[model samples]
Target: MPRMLDVSDEVRAEIGDEEAARLLAGESAPGSYDCTSCRTPGDSAQERTSTVLFIGDETAVLAFAHATCLPSQVVQVTEEQLQGAVRAIGGTGAESPQQQYQSPQHPQQQYEAVQQTPQEPQPQAANLVPEQAVLGVTSGLVLLQGELHPALVVEPTAPVARPGSLGSGDDFLPLLIEQGFMPLTELAGVPPVLHGWSVLLAAGQLHAVLQPSPNGGRPVAWWQAHQPLQVTDGWRAAANKHQQVLMFAAPVGSIGRQPREDLLRDALDKAAANGKLVASALPLAGI
Candidate 1:
């Protein structure tokens, strides 16, 4: 993993010149500021300073803490790091510390849109049970369809925890969106009506569908997978053609295994030939 380099101006001001220099040099000296809640040692022992590095041209932020701390420590450090920095500098601004990161022009508009949207109603068992029961027993059913004209159709049935009880699977939509698939606009108008069924249409069609378990009694749980196929010359071609692909279709549940390096290399070669880049997700070595 790469250490973060660039920090915000506010962060620099909070730590002052000497402490900031030590952190940038990758030194976590004694007497540095630690997050009060997480209790992880800070970059410098003299002040309570947590390091925040925005990785890869500000694409994402990755914060590091002491090895003994929990993952939640990163979250806690992130929540307060900026604000604490602001307070350290003794600067008073109209906006709260949290608001400093927001792009000024769109903040109000974004807040208003969120307020205007009504909460979606929960899904009922009466509607979801029938679909889940049927799909759970079907074999080789087209859970996801690929190699379509210009888009893919994902037909994942809603996951069912109970025949009629509200389920966590109903709430997986936002996760899918975060993964770069566009939520079907039609489905967004209504809440949980489609259960877990979502259609993501991109330059290629990506489908997330449920797979039935061998056991007959358990309500079907949701799984997401995608297939990339190109449609050209009026013929549907079934070939993998996505850059940043995530596949959960592996026979083994853990997709983070490293023994399949050979297979991954071959796939990367194929993708490169097609003018696409391959990025694989590897599990942390000790983790």
Candidate 2:
């Protein structure tokens, strides 16, 4: 046999039957509870007695401090605020705010009237480029494959021809002219581009290569150009071992009429830091 549970009048007056059941069943805590806002360990009785009512679901709980003690402002809520709150909480089907209030219908209307109307075009960061452009650059890098091998291989077509270009030296300059950028497809199995030339990163730091350029001809090879690679996307993983450097070119007017090597170095360094250098092969030599 179980002993009958005794109910106190004070408890019954403070919280209704449904909430009381919930509190007992561990679904919720009693309304008159200690929180960081309300009860400091050494607070006086006067502070403790300054109770505020937090009502919800037809039940009210006593908080041991005034509404000002809580971090949020205590605005007198209206029908619209109530509706917004309900929507925010996903109605009774989801978790709702633990507290609510009821006021005279006229006062509620007045409160709703005083609520600041939402403004159009909320302030946001201005986008210099569309989201799609950024995404395209990212996707292109994902498609490129191979280790970054750095070697000063002559571009098939170029103003400066490699030794024995007609026969002995590989005529890579013609390939560069035909293709504005390096075709990543050609260097799938080769080492990363860094293997050939020393990369001067934007951060004023130098990443020395495993192999020096043939004659130190503009760090990168002509064959590896026009490929979109982001530094952030792991340059070493995508560069061809035969290629010496990964040149990053700026857009038209980005570096004025002619692109400076110093500017390229600075851009590369920043890209490296931000992890934004996705393309590996761009024509950065001369221009």
Candidate 3:
């Protein structure tokens, strides 16, 4: 039986005409599978489904999702990120009939990344440890306008200075504001989309936050997880439903790692009340 799957041209190009035809002809596609975006059961033969191609440096995984949840498209990812996905995905990810790829399963690590850049340039001795300049990232679902939205809270572990500024005050929120993130007075509604910025999630895990490169070739990682950080299934479901993720950034100590969602929300509210929160919504990338 031919599967009712939607494969975009870009994805088709990457997979080649022969492979694409095989998929369209119901040769290798699955009839029943879990939706990559929402993590719910979806039937490709009964309803419209999207074929999402996640391509890494050396491997590619084709995952299925409801067309309503996600469109058929090609998603670019790093090999490490892809392997991370494969580890989490297990048998849920597929590519072609002749090939089944799996990475050496590794223990899942769950920690968000924080970005720390000095506000001003300073002349210092070379050899600096990268870990000292890090940002702390937290993932939780936020309730807004009667809907729950997946959000990422970012803060530096220490005062963040501009890349080459001489002055030395925390510039985390200010720098984000300059980049088009709007300051939040309250969390009553969703933040506006931050163009050219995206949050990458593969296999329902948080991978990295990407920002537009100043040089304008490809976007660069603003904050990347040391390893793929595991997120709650609720967070992933919310992210897939909304097709975006809200990102809130504050200065150091504004929002710490809260052990629970309620605590996280409370911290966000406190940050807003104290006028220390900035937020924007970025389109969700990958699965």
Candidate 4:
């Protein structure tokens, strides 16, 4: 029996026509699988399924998603991220797929949980070790040069120490400046878009910001969520309307933990004036 599967042109090109035809004929396609995007059960024999290709540095994995939840497309991911996904699919991760997808009773809740944290715990701080720098993201619309643009303000919760110089009072901005992030004198113009880096937004919510892999094949999530972060309706509307956002990153001491949105903007202004800010504009791509 034939299945209702969407073998996109890109997927076909990558997997070749013969393999795609085999999948359509049910020789290779799984009867039921979890939606790659939303983590819900999907039946290819009953409803249309989108063939999603995840390409890593040296390997490519094919996954399936419901046509309604996610359109078929090729997603470039770091090898590690792809391996994690493979582990989840193979039920080798700490939590089995059933357990991971079992909670989130509501569809909306499930959608929000799509960007679950990796099975490995983040390195923790001990009594002798300082806490890792955690970047806090605040989203708002900033009026720049008489134009309103959606922007994300990132501030480290604590001072970030340079490698081998812990607690040396070194600011984080200079470290980022050594990278490609540009110092913004003013928000008069949008920052340059960094290649292979993008903000992930889908179904009107922010998921994560991704950076390219060191091996240079694909991008991986730099920051992801156990639970999706909430944003204002206005901010979400802005993201959906413009389909992009500006990301500003600064060192911990640069912003000093703003207490309110107005205060946060003030801190950003100060950082710009002090030449301690780096920024980039990113398009909203799906995770």
Each candidate: how many clashes? 14, 46, 10, 0
**Model 2, 1-287: lDDT tens per residue?**
11112223433334446543543343433233232121222122223222222222322223222222332112122223233322322222444225332233222221111101111111111111211111011111212243332222111111223334454432232333332433332223322333332332111111111123345532322221122111322332232222134443222222222144345434434543443322233211100
**Model 1 lDDT-worst window of ten:** 110-119
Whole-model lDDT per candidate: 0.25, 0.26, 0.73, 0.63
Q: Kindly report the root-mean-square deviation of model 4 from the true structure over all alpha carbons.
A: 9.1
By lDDT, rank the candidates, best first: 3, 4, 2, 1
lDDT of 3 by residue, 131-185 (tens): 3546777788999998899998887778877777676777777788999999998
Candidate 4 lDDT over residue span 230-273, tens digit each: 45666755665565788898776777656666787788888888
Q: How many clashes does the backbone of model 1 have?
A: 14
lDDT of 4: 0.63
All candidates: TM-score: 0.20, 0.17, 0.79, 0.59
lDDT of 1 by residue, 102-142 (tens): 21322221110000111112221211232252111111111
Candidate 3 global TM-score? 0.79
Candidate 2 ranges with C-alpha deviation above 4 Å: 1-142, 145-159, 162-196, 204-287
Candidates 1 and 2 compared: the better one by TM-score is: 1
Name the lDDT value of residue 28 in candidate 3: 72
